[model samples]
Target chain A: MTTTEKIRGLILKVAKGKLSQEALKPEARLSEELGLDSLAQSELLVLAEDSFGIKFTHDEVWTVATIGQMVEVIDSRLAAK
Target chain B: MRQSAGILGTGACLPEQVLTNLELAERFGVTPDWIFERTGIVQRHIAAPEQACSDLAIAAARQAMENAATAPEEIGMVIVATITGDYTTPATAAIVQGVLGIPAVACFDLSAACSGFVYGMIVGSHAISCGFCNKVLVVGSEVLSRFTNQTDRDSAILFGDGAGAVVLGGVPEGYGLLATDAGTCGTEYQAIIIPAGGSRLPPSAETIAAHLHYSHMDGNQVFMFAMRVLGNSTLRTIEKAGLSLDDISLIIPHQANRRIIEAAAGRMELPLSKIVINLEQIGNTSSASIPIALHGVLTDGRIRHGDRLVLTGFGGGVSWGSALIRWHSPGSDQIHKKEKNDDNN
Candidate 1:
C-alpha cells in the first residue's frame, strides 16, 4: 500500500470510523474536521507508536493538526531513529 | 539462575478518621461532585496529630509479619519507601526496626514518590535473591496529609495518610518475580515537588509564610507523563519476562486517578476488569498506593496462587517501575496449610 493508504488506515482506526470521507483529504484538520479530543489524540499517538514502533514526544504530538501533518510527523519520527 | 523472591503476605493500615469529599468541598469552596468528577476520590484517611509516618509503618509491618508468620528475628532487613518519613535525619525503617525490636537488622529508606512500593519490591526481591537476607520487610508508608496545603484544591483533594507492607522471601524458583523494570527522567524532576524543607531551601519563617512547604504539581504534565509511562513500562516489563499479554491475569497499577489508569488501559488494550483500583477509598497515598491496593485484592482473594500479577506505578522522582510477580501466599504452602486449616476452625 502507498503512504497515503497506510496513513488513512491509521486515521480511520484511531478515529473509530468517525472521520468522514471528506475528512480523509490530506489537508483536512484532524481536530476541527474529525473532532478528535486531546485524550483521543494521545490514544492515536499510542496506536501510531505501537503500530510503527516509533515514539513522539509531547511537544511533537501537540503540533499535529491536519492528517497530512500527522503522517509527516510519523514519517519524520520513524526516519529520525 | 537467580533465586526468586515473592511476597509472602501483605497488610495495610489507613487512619481511623475519614474526610469525605463533601467535607473537603466545604473546606475548598467547591461542590463534592466537582471534586469527584476530577479526582474520583470519595473519602480519604487523615493521620492524627500524634501519629507519624513511623506509627502507621509499625502497625502495617506488624500485620504483614503476622500474615507471613515471619518472626522479627528472621527478617534481615527493613526497607521503608516514603517521602513523608518520620524524620529526615534517622531513616524511618530504622525507627520501625527499633519498634519491632528486630535488633541489628539493616534498615534504610528510599524516595520514589508514589512509585515507592514498586521500587521497594525490586530492592527487596534482589536482597533475598542475592542471599543478602533470608527475609525482608518492605513498607510504603506516607503521611501526605501533613504536607498538603489544606486550601490548595489541586493537591489537598488528592492526598491521604496510610501505609502498606509486605514480607518478602524465597518462593519456588520459576513461580516468583519474572521481570522488573524501572526508569527515571530527571529532566521532569519538578513535575511534582515540595519546594522547601530540603537543604536547598531549608525551612524558615519566610518560607512558611510563602507556603513553600506544601506539595505542588504540574497536573497537566504529570497526567500526560503518567498515562504514557504507566502502560509503556508495564508492557515492556511483561515482554521482558518472555511472556505475552495473554499471560497476564491482573494488573495492579498506581491508584492515582481513574481516568489516567482508564486511558492508559485503553491504550494498552487491557480491560478495566483486569485492573485493580482503590483510590476512591484511600485517595492518592503516594508510595502506599500499589501495596495498599495489593493488600486489598489479596485479602478479598481476587488473586490466587500461580496467578501472574503486574505491579506498576509512577511518581515524583519523575520515576516509574513495574514488577511481574507470580502469586504465592504462605497459606497456600503445604507447610502452612495444616496450620491455616486449624486456625480456620
Candidate 2:
C-alpha cells in the first residue's frame, strides 16, 4: 500500500470503534474531525512510528493536526531514511 | 529452595471526599468531558484536611489484618510504600505499626513511586522465603493531593489519595509467587518527578515560591515509557514463570491511564476483558493502585483458587515490575489440584 494508505490504516486502528472510515478524508483534523483526543493521538503516533519505522520529535507531534499532515511527515521521514 | 509466600488477604481505604471531573474542570476552565477523554478518570478520592498518609495506612492495615485473621502481634514486618509520607524523616510504616499495635518489628518505607507495591511484594515474599518473618504487612499509601498543584491541570486531574494493604505469609509449595521482573531507567527519571523537597533540591524559601514541591510530569514521556515497559515487563515475568499470556487468568496493572493499559494489552494481543482497571472511579493512586485493584477483584469474587495472575506496574523511577502468582486460597484446604497431582507423581 502507499504511504498515505498505510498512515490512514494506523489512524483507523487507533480510531477503531469510535470513528467511521467516511470521516477520514485527507483534510480531516485529528482532534476535531476524527475525535482523536490527546491520549488517542499519542497512541496513533506510536503506532505510526512502529509501522513506518519513523520517530517524531516533540514539536512535530504538536504540529501535525490533520491526517494529511501526518501523512506528509511520515513520507518525508521515510524519504530521509 | 525457598518457601513460597502468598497474600492472605487484602484491603483498601479511599478518602471520604470525592473530586468529580466537573469540579476539577471548573478550575482549569475545561469541560468535564475534556478531562475524561484525555485521562479516562471520572473522579478521585481526596483526603480530608486533617487526614494524612498514615491515617489511611492505619485504616487499611487494620482491615487487612482483620481479613487475614491476624492479630497485631502476628505481623513481624511492616513495609509502607509511598513517596507521600506523613513526615520527611519518620517512616509512615512506623506510624502504621504503632497505630495498629503491630508489635515493634522491622518497619520502614519504600519509595519507587507507582512501582512501590510490587517492589514491596518482592521484598515481603523474600522475607518469608528466607524464613526471616512469619507474616509481613505491605501497604501502599499516598496523599498526592497534598503535593498536587491545583493550578496545574496535568498533575491535578490524574492523582488521588488512598491506601491499600495485603497480608503476606507462607503458602503451600507450588503456590504463591512464581516469578518476578523489575528494572529501572535511571537516565529517564525526570519523566515524572517532584523537583524539590528532597536533599538534591532541598526545600527553601526560593523553592516554595517557585511551586517546586508539586509533582511535575512530561505526559508524552511517561506515556511512551509506560506503553513500552508495561507489556514487555509482564511478558518477561510470564516467561520467567515458565508460562505464557494464555496461562494468566487476570492482569492487575498500575492504574495510570486507560489508554496506556489498552495499548499494553494490544501489544500483548490480549483482550481488555482480562485486565482489571479501576482508575475511572478512583483515578491514579500511584503505588496504591495495584493492591486496590487486586482487592476489588478479590472482593467481587473475580479471583478464584488455582487461578494464575500477573500484577504489573510502571512509574516515576521510570521503573517497572511484574509478579506472577498461582493463587492458593488462605485459610482453606483448596490447594492447586494439578500441583498436588505433580507432587504425588
Candidate 3:
C-alpha cells in the first residue's frame, strides 16, 4: 500500500468506533479534529508500528503531526530501507 | 446538639478462589518477580462465576451487622460504593438491601472507584450527625476480576474481587467522625476508566470486539495522580479535624499499590508502620480496600478505643477523599449486659 493509504488505514483502525473515513482529512489535527487524545494518539502510533513493521522514535512521534506528515516520514523511512 | 456516629462494627469477605502472582505472570507474559517488585501484590481473590458483586456485599454486610449486634430494622440507610454493579438500572445497594431484608432503609450505590468506602463513610457519618439516620450500613464491593482482561498485565495483576462493610451508630460526645474532605476532577476521567458500556458509547457487538467492556488505564499518569492526591487528601483531613499529623495513630489508605502508598507516606514524613498494607493479599479491591484493611487491623487488635485514625483514598474519576475519626466503642460490659437483658426479654 502507498504510505498515505497505510497511514489512513491505520488511523481508521485505531479510531475504534469514534472516527470514520468521512471525518479523516489529510490536514485534520488528530486530537482536535479527529478527537484522539494523547493516550489515543500513542495507541495509534503503536498500532501503526505493528501494522507497518516500523519502529518510531520519541522525536518522530512529535515530528509527525498530521496524517500527511506521517505518510511522508514513513515514505522516507521506506526509501532509506 | 451534634450526634457522633462511630464505627460500631467492621467486616470483610474475600472469594474462595485465589490467583497468585506466579499464575497471573505466566498468563500475561511477564516475570512473577517483576510484578511483585512493582506492586507488592502476591495473591488476590476471584469470585466464583455464579457470584456477583451484591452477593459479596450481602455477606460482608451480614457480618458487620452481626458484629455490631444491630438488626436490619434499625438501619436507616445503606450505601454501597462500587463501579461494577449487577446492572446499570437498579443500584447494587438496593439489591443488597432487598437480599438482607432491610427494605425500609434508603439504598443506592456510589461510583468513586477506590476511594468509595471512605466517601461512603463520610456520607454515612454526615447522615447520622445531622440526625437524618440513626444507623447506617456502608459497604464497598467489587467483582473486578470478572471485568479485568486476563491478558492485560497492566491491570490484571492489580485488581481482585472482595467486599467490606462497616456499621455506624450514634456515639456520645467527644467521639466518632471529626472531619472529611471529598473532591473530583472529571477532566482527567480518561486517565482510568472503562472505555465504553455507557450512554456515551452504548454496548454493541462492535464495542465488545474492541474490548471496551474491560478496564483501561494509563498506569504512569494514574500513578502520578494517586501520589499527589493521597498526600493532599490526608493533609486536608488532618487539618480540617484541627489535628496535626502526629495525632493520627493509623493511616488507612486505599491498597492500589505499595509504591503509591510509600511515596505518599514519604511526602507526609510518616512511617510505613503506621500505614495499613493489605494489597499483598487482596490486590486492589478498589472501594473495598479501606474497609477491608480497617477490618484486618481491628481483628488483629492494632486499633483500639480512643485512638485517632485518618482514612484516605484516590481512584478513577480522579476522585479522592479523606476522613478523620476518633475510635470510641460502647463498653463491652454494656454490650454483654444489653445482650443478656435482651435475651431475658
lDDT of 3 by residue, B1-345 (tens): 989888988879999999998898888787888788678899999999999999999999998888788888989999999999888979999999998889567899988998889889989988999989899999999999977987788888889999999999898777888888899989889988898899999999998898888999877567657766887888888898889988889999999988778766654567888899998989999999999898888766677678889889899998999888898864332234445666798
Q: Per-residue lDDT for B104 in model 2?
A: 83
In DockQ, how does model 2 score against the reference complex?
0.45
lDDT score for residue B62 of model 3: 94
- Candidate 1 structure quality by residue, lDDT tens digits, B252-280: 99888876788788777888888998989
Question: lDDT by residue for model 2 over B269-342, one digit each (tens)?
Answer: 77798999998999999999999998888777678888999999899988998899898787622233334655
Each model's DockQ?
A: 0.20, 0.45, 0.02
Clash counts for all predictions: 0, 0, 0
Best by DockQ: 2
Instruction: Highest TM-score: give the candidate number.
Output: 2
Which one wins by lDDT: 1 or 2?
Answer: 2
What TM-score does structure 1 among the candidates reach? 0.84
Q: Write the residue-wise lDDT of candidate 2 on A1-81 in tens digits.
A: 987788777888888777767888999999998988777788888778778877788789789999899999888888888
**Which of the predicted structures, 1 or 3, would earn the higher lDDT when compared with the native?**
1
Candidate 2, superposed: residue stretches over 4 Å from native? A17-35, A53-81, B332-345
